[model samples]
Target: MRFFGIFCIVAILCCDLAAAESPLVVIVHRSRHSPISVEEVARIFLKKQRYWKDGAPVVPINREARSASRRVFEQYFLVRVRSDLVAYWNEQYFHGVFPPATLESDEAVKRYVGADSNAIGYIAADLVDDSVRVVHRLD
Candidate 1:
């Protein structure tokens, strides 16, 4: 019984560690019709740039707060939280500039951005599929 408990604990820990360390990836719309570089992706995440070359309005979508995925994204891609990022957005929003939109779920983000020409988002590296094109990989 003790051995079984120890094994379960070890297995749980391994699963958690694996989740915590999952690599994050950035992706753009499948119909975007442009090739993007890491620098360009970084710019979009930081809200420094807002449009693709084809004049499509670029919308950046983010995960919900408290999600493990959100932590990874902020630690690697975005540099701030919604309240703070909103402050940053507010500064630009009034100027006719906008920050990336926030989405609640991976599925919603995937569906909206994957089908739209003006949307982009980041998700787990392994979760990327043919419906989305990876633009950046976070270490």
Candidate 2:
């Protein structure tokens, strides 16, 4: 019984560490197969590029402001500090452009992106499935 208990604890800790280290993936609906670069993704998230090649409005979904995934996404993709990003959004608000809509969890982001052809969002790589196609990965 003692050996079993210790084994379980070690297994749980290993799982947690693996989950924490999972890469982040940017996803679109499964139907979207076009290649997108990091710069273009940044532009879309910033609301600078508002439409897809087919004239459909590009919808960028962000994880909530307080999420760790959001921090990573902004760091790797936006490449702007929080204060600078805030200032940029402030300027954009004046021009009628706004930051992307935010969802609270990876599951929600996946569902939204899966349902909308023009929508794009990011989630932990481990959560990815058939509902969405990964367009980028931040390793």
Q: Could you tell me every candidate's TM-score relative to the true structure?
A: 0.66, 0.85
lDDT tens readout by residue for model 1, 38-90:
66776887778877787766787876655666677776655566687668767
Extract clashing residue pairs from model 2.
none
Worst 10 residues of 1 by lDDT: 12-21
lDDT (Cα, tens digit) per residue for candidate 2, span 79-106: 9999999999999999888789998678
Q: Residue 108 deviation, candidate 1, in Å? A: 2.3
Distance from true position, residue 107, model 1, in Å? 2.5
> What's model 1's TM-score?
0.66
- Kindly give the number of clashing pairs for every candidate: 0, 0
Error of 2 at 80 (Å): 0.8
